[model samples]
Target chain A: MRHRLKDVAERAGVSVKTVSNVVNGYVHVRPDTRARVEEAIAELNYRPNLSARNLRKGRTGVIALAVPELDIPYFAELARHVVTAAGVHGWTVLVDQTGGGPEQERVAASGIGDHMIDGLIFSPLALTADDLTGLDGIPMVLLGERVDHGPADHVAVDNVAAAREVTAHLIGLGRRRIAAIGAQRTPEGASARLRLEGYRAALAAAGIGYDESLVAPASAWHRADGAAAMRQLLASGARPDAVFCFNDTLALGALRALHEARLRVPEDVAVAGFDDIEDGRFSVPTLSTVSPDKEAIARLAVELLAGRLAGERAAPARELSAPYRLELRESTEGPADA
Target chain B: MRHRLKDVAERAGVSVKTVSNVVNGYVHVRPDTRARVEEAIAELNYRPNLSARNLRKGRTGVIALAVPELDIPYFAELARHVVTAAGVHGWTVLVDQTGGGPEQERVAASGIGDHMIDGLIFSPLALTADDLTGLDGIPMVLLGERVDHGPADHVAVDNVAAAREVTAHLIGLGRRRIAAIGAQRTPEGASARLRLEGYRAALAAAGIGYDESLVAPASAWHRADGAAAMRQLLASGARPDAVFCFNDTLALGALRALHEARLRVPEDVAVAGFDDIEDGRFSVPTLSTVSPDKEAIARLAVELLAGRLAGERAAPARELSAPYRLELRESTEGPADA
Candidate 1:
């Protein structure tokens, strides 16, 4: 049976008002009375009416984390860190999958639904700067790709530097003919574009002329897309010595494609990817990739959101960069001089 | 700015009572007035105070989904489906990770935190039947593993049948010696135990004596655990012609170990797994496993919770069985007479 405040007070030999004061954290309560009330609460197993309390405070102790898809290992791992970080702030996290759709992104951004969250930590795939205008006063922290002048605090690793490092690592392995997968042409593909620019920069630094034909475009960053792109590259007779995929999923797919085509990894064509997800660590020839500091990113995002929710609404949005490192694994550790 | 009912009332040229009537789904409002009010609500993009409304109704539009871990691809994939299924009921899902800790499981099962959810869909790993007593009145639906006489509805695929089918398939490949990975010897390991039982049953059906050394024990169903178990089996000189893993993650790890040992899959030993996760589909030799109808499990769990929330509290808790099928892939489809 659910215990009422009156029952708790009666059990504690105190009045209902005193019990309410104790439950609400009123500082004027006597220590002995508070102890008695707490005992009664424990005995009765009385849980506070959180909805009613939050209603009066005009704040729900819940936040939302919106991502493109939960099935993606990168997002799932990142979300695990986010949930852990959010727990430090005594907040619960509700997840929303936007499926990379503009309409769903807008709905999540606006927080216009029956279950209103105190804030949102969003990793957008489809939303643009224009879509971020007028956000209905819901605090939000942006993750992944940067939105120019977007009205939210942002947290991410330096994608360009990370990608450039991966490419340079491959070039250092004597891979002159390097193919790039996951080049996106849309404006919303900001992160992919940055990585592509990084790849070109590395090629320029190494005095290797960029080949347009070696750059493959994948509309979506999934295994199927990567596999199809790799197949197209092979079918077109582009015998690149190395392939740099935009992400780990794409790289794994490229590996499968290479396997299907009877091309040995690293021996024939070295492969590299970004985002050191768990799958990469166990792949047949373990993947070489860039490992973003996901925990720091998650912690920073939640801290920024907590700051905004804690009456820092007028503070200028901050852009924080987390760290990233290159994980040179079996996928790219080919012959010293092939 | 957050718009109020009075703002919508003025924009629609109606009284506050009429606006409230339309918003609250009172049927007495005129159709034209309702349309005008809805238009104003749209123009203003007003969102109702969900906490306040839910408090008055003694319900929260939020539900909790407590899983052991999200980084595990299986749970991540299942969470994606659950979130989609919960969306159909117009309810938001808050995710909590228990980390397979009994204390954490108890806290989640009790729902004692500040955020009170209307219902919970819990996939427990450490929680026991006794820990489920006196749940503080939170409607719950259990997922994965059967807890006999537990005070909640349960939804899952038949573990025994799925495991038996997988083993039988491996045995059908003209393999005499079969090994099983992921044998847990704990009370909390209900699903693993059931799968182990099915493996034994399959061996008995085929009139093959069970080899004690062929059964490998993994403390956890992670890639590392699976790899270590497989390594132990190989080190102990157990040259089983086939191996059935409890889950895909374990199978993937085992595959990596086999690769390390220079053993060709399905030539020296055929491999099988359970839970046809996305990773399994993309594995080097695409995994052969049981594909549980995850969408159906998610939908049925949500439907049961919705029923309980919609005044079916007295109904006897249901035990719903979801469908499953074996997906034969490159992992197990060896030569005709290997």
Candidate 2:
């Protein structure tokens, strides 16, 4: 599965130095020769060892933090924590946005273009276990939802438990009709699937039958998607007394829609969300949500990566769990008689 | 004023190879020699030629983006655009947060640890002209407020004009007692000063005397500071009919304070902000802001940096201006008869 430079050269019918020139972006290679070499690289799934080339000479003391997107406040806040944590190790972090797509996520996981980083801390959105099969020579620590076992160290919050707790909090408020936003219809929605399962478990525990109509699916977890999903649920006349969004951004969007519809928060509908981003703290009604220990996640991820980079290839992969707590705010605190 | 490796060696009373080892982070260098070399490096401000070392061998196809903080939505959004722009040039962007401090900004400007990047697009907060004097070998494009002339290519919106337009809009809404938030009382506050000047010019043009009490200073442009500044203004009994925030986050924070005080937006106080971030779009009553062409800024900055890296160093540094427009949402659309 591991293809070397010589293998690429043999397949392209060119010298190793020619393939090297193409990989290194040297302009002297002929167009046809470069095309042939690139085709061979694609067919063989060859990842050039440029990252290792720098590592072998000396420590670059630079690590890469690859996230789904920087525009998401959660990722932005998480990136800040990671940068601060990495600074303590005397390592500079280079932040890369993978765009949460398979192609970009795969490129980040493969360490394709980051030839200067000593290791990578990657939070993948669509990369699968099969895609991670031959991660040849990079020290990687995974963050967020688990894709598979035995590949890399992972640091994440207990999403299922946190979701269950949030749903239970809504149920305890005597709300029989509850809505769940941010359900994904794809297999790559591992995080969404887990949260949905927790919501179902909470409803079943409360002896309430699950209503399919109350579960809204979102293609992406952005404010626009959340608003559209909320509008769709309302148009369907589900009339849910409480809404539990998968993240804070969705909750904020829902709040905007409710305000537009002239519905009072907590009095008519109690709304809750996960991932207590900073915006939630200052939102009009002050959103209630789950607050994962982002600092712990960042620190543990960097520590695990440092261990792997310090020649701990023989050590077993670690799956570290970060702590989280529910933040009960004005948005979720309904009247006792409701 | 440029110091070389030989200069550092001579100052440290050591060989150039030893200085090189110390600069390259080799662990074999003795503690005393390393300390002496570090002292000499600091005393002479010797920036190692590591970034150039990789550039001479071959293009690394990587550029670094140094911003103050990623937690700020504006910078995060700008970084996303820059990454997308760099991808078009077949270059990967390495994002670095300079923390808006002199030491960190100086380090980022000097290109000390980013040896793999061929260029840097830096938006410095506290760095001054003297700090940028001996930027010897790195190719850099400056963003945000102008720090010095003839040093680097600059890309930014006309901060003063944008601020004036926003203030004039508030004035046109028949708001006589207009307050300005985010006035910095520091020499490093170039952006803030420009915005303040624009606000003053707008007031002067309207024949309205500038009230010193209406200008509130925020140490930092975060939501917390905005909320605090608004609170201080309210407590000081400066009942302004309008508030113009320097940025969107501060405006969002001021909105929170207004809501807590039960003041209906536009009816009680018309609010305006700069930087049309996504959060402002979804905020209740929706914010009226100045929308700078961020895409154009990103593209122009990357193009300028690419040009410099392509051996256009002798070319005169150019200053490019992006366009902007006023976004008038419900927050600024007060009752016409009032």
Candidate 3:
């Protein structure tokens, strides 16, 4: 015979309501009571029939996570961490890639929340604050950028601060003529724009002229695009002492371009990148980068969403600014004289 | 007013059954009939109320993909491709990382199916064929390794042939004292065992001595583990002309260790790795490695699972041996005379 909730409650010396509360993860339950209920659950080997409960409650016990593209290491790693974190709470994460198109982003956002998932953790690439009107009534946590939706939780690193720090590192290394790649004219409030602002701020602080010509624009955030941007900057005859790429993929491509141009890294042109991907450590003349706590972000996002799902007290919207570590590696260490 | 299915059928000049067939993705309908139904759907803006449909039929349009870990770039990239491919069929992929443990693998497999997901794409790590007993009811496609006990389909690259080809590449370079890293003792059917067997076969064919001392074992598949194994190998007083790492992460770690030891690659110690990750190209000395068509594998897995979900014919158990490319870069290409 299958064990029931009453049996568990009787074994634990708790009321049936208390047992239900513990199973539902009610925050009000005492720790000892929760432990007793858990013990009873373990002893009986009672597994909650989630599907049956979901059927009655009109919930799927699944959440969707929409990212830009996973071919990029940063997003790929982020998705992995998010999936692992969600697994801890017994919630499955459905992944969707928007391919960096505004229409696709909107479609993914609208489609995923239509009874297919209980909530969404969206890291959008194209949608802007203007597109927030259609995203109401959905349980979502925005990542990567701040959307102007009134009351949704958000989890993102401080892109502006991280960029500024990287720029400052290059400046302190005596690289006055530093070029910045990934200068895309995206929608307002996008992470790219914020990063550009930070770069400009760093230049201003260093008393260096911020030349628009030094900002190489890329159409997309791919390695090839970064290479093309670097090539364009080099062809323009503006010999930069250093280059700050928007992300590691672009930085990797830029490094290859520099190698092809017979320009030695740090000795000739210093290079720094963001998002300290695993490959950065192994890259030729290892990359100097800002390492964001991706795992922590994933953990916090999952916990926040789980809290919301259980109908816990309305927690205030949280915007966590994870610390970014500046790794001083071979790429931006500069020449001995400098 | 919301248009009824009957209204859609009448307007499209098709029987209700035919309209239902198109809506449900039934394969029996003719192309012209499907086009008519689709046109009618578009014109009428007939969006199926998935909640109501799910209420009637207890099916969720979600599938689970269980991988060992996404920290491994191969699995990370594979998951990205799989998620994209599954999206084309109006399905979402729920990702689970098993950490290569038998208990976690079993939990992921059973949990996903019990949660009412339509199907699963499982990549088991530690679970052997015997542990898969009593898991026969679900529609699943096994990836990476084969396990008997279910009618579920299997999709994987020929690991033995790929490994042998990579090892042969090293032999062709005239490196007699080649070392193999990432040797792990597991069940006979595991990927590690098969790859090891391939390595042995390649050595035998080349008429080179197989030194058991040269094979270094790693407790896990990570860059740190690779670094430790390489350090141990170097300390053991056995100098190898070449090192064939099991995967790219291990190879990358080995490269780092070699750099610390003041050893030059290709000229002093040639190195090659499997799974040509994007970062491998940017490594200070670009890595020579074997590349698999991960996109093809992802597409095939999604197609197979879709067929099963649609009640299509149980196609023959397919073992797709994707062609592997030997990317010869600076790591394994020494100076002309060296």
Candidate 4:
């Protein structure tokens, strides 16, 4: 049998309003009264049926997070951090995969206004800035590219800066023949474009001319694509002394391809990547990566959303950047006998 | 300005109830009326708010999945699969990490009834049969370690059988003095116990005396823990010709330790693990292990939970065993000299 608020109120010898106030965590309630109400609630096993409570307040204490895909190590790691961050706020996280498509991203963005959840944290793959016009009313914290600067709060590392830093690190070791892998041909290629720009900047800063022939094509930011891109780069006669991949998954795939080709890492080809995933730490040759503070991004996004949900939206759309560091490992420890 | 259902109803030239019927996906509405209502909805950009609708039906079209920790690759991969499976049923998945503690596990299980969600799919790390008592009222599907049959439907791989097969595979390769890592010391370690039992079963079948000295203790099922266990085994003067880790994380850790000790894999000591995580597929030696059909497990858990949410409580709680296979890779590819 289900217990009601009235039953708890009766058992606690308090008004129903008082019990409700205690349940809602109102500060006006006396500590003793709150204790008594909680005791009664425990005695009767009365859980506040969140759906009914949310119906009255239009706040479900849950948030939707739509990412390109969780199967990807970066997204999976991001989702893990987001879930941890949401837990601190006593909020649940509803995860959806957009399959990196505009239609699904739209559905995910629109879901905030349509679903029972409080807000959304979206990391779009295919959705453009214009695609976000209709999603203006929702409480959203955009992750990944700042394709548009309209209404949503944004959290991300300085992609261009981080990429530049990684490329510069490789260049410092006298590696000029650097091939960039995982280049996407879409508006969603915001990461690719920014990272490539950073790579070009580093090359320019070092007075090295940019080489377009070294750019490898990728259907998506995945391991298989990275491997294919590496194979193509190998076959195209564009022999690069170093490979800088967009993400860790791509870099790992490239490493696998190099291993199959009987090339010793950092001896024949130095390697570097972004999004320092766990696998990078455990990989055979380890991995050198631009370690973006993913947990920071997740925490900041949740905190920003919480602030907005608490009706404290008083900014020109609050934006925060995650800190990043260059982690050097065996993969890019420089050429052997240096 | 936000559009309302009433505005759409007026534009469609229909009563609010007729428009509501069409919005709720009721099939009784005439085709033309349905078309008119849909057209009006599209024109006005009216979105149905799910909170109000869920208040009427007590279903939020969202389910909670509580796992030990999403930071673990196995659980993260499992969460991805669960999200995909939930999508097929037009349901959303809210994930919670329990930190693999008894208190956290209890909180996650209780969340199903207290939150604005339908049902729960739980992978408990520190919960026992006794701990799952009050959770019976909430619709739940249990995963991992069949310690007891309880009231909830369960889904998991046949841990005992799978462990036996993997161990038998090692024995067939002329490996003796096999060591086992990640033997949990808590009652919550049902998976550990079942797998250990299967290990003992295999040894008995192979006419090899069970060696208790080879059983190393691990505080948790992690890479670091596995590494520590392997180190302890090495220091204890227990020379094992083969190592069977409880999970991939542990196996990877063991491999790292072995690498540090300059032990050639398969030549010095062949290694195997459970849970064919993606990392295992790409690890240096390409870990040999028991590959449980994780996608199938996730699909079955979602299907089981869907059935309960759909009010289909039938004959005695249905329990299923996930498909398993022994994937022999470079780790157990036999002695390199051979």
Candidate 5:
């Protein structure tokens, strides 16, 4: 049964007005009556209605992080940093998993939870720039899987540049015939396109034409997908001297395939990955990969969202790319160093 | 500036009563007046105040997942399952990182966000059963650390039984002088104690006297702490033929230390860890671990919270334990198999 103001008033032996005054923190109530009303409220577990007051105040002190999913290590780690950053700014985080689908992404962007959230950090995977026309007035910042931007704030690393840098690193290690792993036939907002472009740019810079046969297609960018792609590449008789996986998850999978095949990394077949996940550090031969500053991206995105929520508008929209670095580890560090 | 209802009413050229009726979906408003009010609302980007409605209805349609932090892989994975399970029950999750401290855990449990959340799924690292006394009125489910039940739902795996099973497996593998890694002096709950007890039970069952020197203490459960503890165990010259880490993170770190020390696993020493995290599956030499049914726990906890929200009073408190299994892989597969 729901407890009402009348019930609390009856319990306190006072009128409903007295209970209301006490619950609302009004100073005009008599001291003994106030104490009685407080006792009654506590006994009833009656919470003060904060809706009208919150509506008047116009801030909920809660922000939301809408990611593809929490199971993915990259997004999981990114969410950790985002939650921490939001906490520093006195905001809590509501986490939503959109399953990386266009329909789910639209629902997340439709302000369904706007009543309790001050802003949103949306990372759309399946939605394109054209699909985001309805997100006009939401105070949201975009992360990961770069799309053509709407009027919202966006933060991401330069994927093309990072891929090029990692490819160059492989080239500098005297690795030609580098097989491109994790190539998706259908692109999501130019992410795969930019990475592929960077890989091609590096190959062109080294005077090696892109080999269509060496480009292994993957069903997904997970570890299993990387492993499958490597196996497919091996079966096709490409015999690439090196493999450049799209992400660390794929690279880790490739490393497992290499380990299984008794092929020594860097010595026989050099390998590299993108996104320096924690697993990359703990792999057998620690992974050599690109380390995009994830924490910096989270901080910048949260700060940008906070500013927009506070009605600070320097520009109608802002595009900030987080810095990236090529991290050298044992995976690509050849036998000479050992 | 905050958009006021008066501004919306003025823009719609209607009395505040008509605008309020339109906003509240009251049928007393005419069709043209309703359309005009909605247009003004769209112009103002006005969100219906859910706080007042939620207060009256006594349901927020939101739940909270209060974990220590999402950086840890086990917690991250567990949270993923929880969010999915909650979604199946039509509840959204508001994730809060309690920083693994008693103070923060208390705040998370004290109904601080009760006005906006229907319940909480808390994974406390520092709070004990005694500390959770006053959280009776709130709908919550405790995960991981086994604090005494305080009228809240709880779900966990039997840590003691699983630990014993793994230790017995190590003993069955023809290894003696088994050293324990990742023992915490200050236990969060029966989790560490039960695991340690299980290890001791296995040794006792095998008629091996408890050797204090073989037990290594880790201050925290991270990989670094495990590696440091392993190094300390090595420096002490215990010379154990096998090691059982409290969790996979510690085991991975211990594996790194064992690798650096030139110990070929299962040949020089065998290693086993708890919690079959994803990284454990793809480690250089695949890790052997105890796989707790995380999804089952998530489903049960979410169902329990939903039932509580709907006022199903079949039980005031429920305690459930998910099943676990021992997963064997290359880490302890031995040279004979090789």
Candidate 6:
């Protein structure tokens, strides 16, 4: 009484390929077609047990996502969105915490791939172009980078443009001396370098000299790092009119540090940040930052991975730069006059 | 030559079963023995393709997690923690969003037992004892409620005690008129009902009459629903000096509604929430809430599922409620003296 794929396809009145694609969660299939195919399978009581299917197809119906750490709220939120999007394609996600170490990134990449995940969605903090060479033959979608070491797709926010716009917003408010806080160098295509370049561009446009002392170094992207960096900048006696943090976590830390130092926000010093996380909206004084469309990025990443899994071939890799919007809030614009 | 399980056992000087346990990520193995086996694996360059092994064992290296929704910060954070914990065991997670529907809950249970996943960690918002008829023979770890219809391990917060303590805190603050906000009834074993019972207990201890008019009903546990419910409660002219929301999301909406009505927090009406989310910490004036150890819950849930997958009948239909801590902050207590 076992049902076969052919029987399901015949009952659904579709081509066998369509039924196959539907069962595999291929995104190209129309919703109605998928519904019909699913109905047919249900009527036939046919189940494609992944363990049994793996024997013949060598596809485990799993994908791996390697991010820095889920403990970080940003990554945690991103992982949630990604997992939700992956579920639409009926794919399971195996998460890996790289802890932003080069060695760990390599290990996660190899370990998950060796475990037979069909593809990888990697947001590597420490892996460089050279390190990506070993990732060949694995279908991957790179997040936070533009490197193309393998035949992989890339999805990222344009860090340079987003940073430039955020800096310009601060400059537009008549802030002359602006300090930038982030990593000075990193193995993962230099987020700090790109952000710094954007900061310089904004300063140059405003006819201000880029002060080397204004650039603060952070070992990692966290609130504590941001707090420490801000402390160092304040202790150096260079009183910048404004501070532009790389991310919301660091910005929150910077805000805490500024609060402890008894400096008034937007009055004594304007503050700006990137990545408008949910926390930013609810901070004591709502944060002004560049808002990236996380939902859109997640949806596109999952769609791209699903396409590859469904035998969509060798298309030119995509680089989706999520558009950023500047949200003017209480922190940078001062409290609303009641 | 390919390294076999026996080869790894010989190299690590362990029994074949011990080597197998190490490979399968069983939790009982000694740390030193596991380390030795891992070192041996590295030295031998052993690559155990999980897909190939799954074919032989009839087990997919994946588990399903059914939750109400990820849009809520609590569930989103929980999913992130769960996925990270499951990854330590080399297991992939297939997330199912039930949207708090009874039908969806039933479908999730059926989907897991249909061999789409090797096990399940379910946080059911719907489906009662009556609907649990067909869920036998599935390895599951129930979350939120202790369903008596099946034999499964459960991990949840002490909702009754948490609610009571939170209410008592508000009462101790000298707020006489207190109200509760949550679902009145649901098929998911009445989480809101239990919390309300705790609220009643606190009120009885304080000699305050339980005003039925003050309790607000939400169709679902969402911010918009809370906002609407609060608006209705305010329109009814039943003013409570303090309010206890079932969760942070609802409390956030209540805060917004109160602000719009020109009622300042902890000045005219105090507010307390459950689930100490990151947003709660950053909320304007910060939220006072019942904080659960989400990391500990996630670890326990994954460990329990791992134990069941290993065919260990260690416990039957167990329910373990983690302790909840009350975080005193500006929402219920006035802002720190400026």
Best by DockQ: 2
Residue lDDT tens for model 1, A1-338: 77788998999999989887665545467778877887787688675565665677677666788888877788988988887776544466667777777766877787634445778999988887667865564788999884745888899888888888999999999999999999999977898899999999999999999998999999888888889999999999888989999999999999998988889999899999998998899898899999999988997788688677656788888899999999888899943233
Instruction: Kindly indicate the candidate among 3 and 5 with the higher lDDT.
Output: 5
Tens digits of per-residue lDDT, candidate 1, B13-98, equal 99988877665444466767877987787688665555566777776666778888888888888887887666544456667777
Summarize candidate 5's per-residue lDDT along B1-338 as a digit string, tens digits. Answer: 55777888899998877776654434456767766876787677554444566567776666788888676778878877886666533456667777687755776787544366778888888877667765553777888755746557788888888999999999998888999887776756356788999999999999888899999987678788888988888889899889999999889888888887889987788999998888777777888999999888887777667666655545667788899999998778852247
Which of 2 and 4 is the better model by DockQ? 2
State each model's CA lDDT, in order.
0.82, 0.82, 0.75, 0.79, 0.77, 0.75
Q: Which candidate ranks first by TM-score, i.e. highest?
A: 2
Residue lDDT tens for model 6, A21-138: 8766577788778778867876775755455766566766667677776546676667667866665444556566565766557655664434456777888877765677665446
Candidates 1 and 5 compared by TM-score, better number = 5
Candidate 3 falls in which docking quality class? acceptable
Model 6 residue runs over 4 Å out of place are A1-66, A71-117, A146-150, A220-237, A256-264, A335-338, B1-66, B76-118, B129-133, B146-149, B219-236, B256-264, B335-338
Task: Estimate candidate 5's alpha-carbon lDDT, on a 0 to 1 scale.
Answer: 0.77
**Quick one: how many clashes does candidate 2 have?**
0
Per residue, candidate 4 scores C-alpha lDDT tens digits across B289-311 of 99989888997788677667655
Docking class of 4: acceptable
lDDT of 3 by residue, A139-198 (tens): 677788646343567788888888999999999988899999887675733767878888
Interface RMSD for each predicted structure = 2.3, 1.1, 3.0, 2.8, 1.8, 4.9
Comparing 1 and 2 by TM-score, which wins?
2
Root-mean-square deviation of every model: 10.5, 18.2, 6.9, 9.9, 14.9, 7.1
DockQ of candidate 2 is: 0.49
How many backbone clashes does every candidate have?
0, 0, 3, 0, 0, 0
Residue pairs of candidate 2 with colliding backbone atoms: none
State the TM-score for model 4. Answer: 0.80
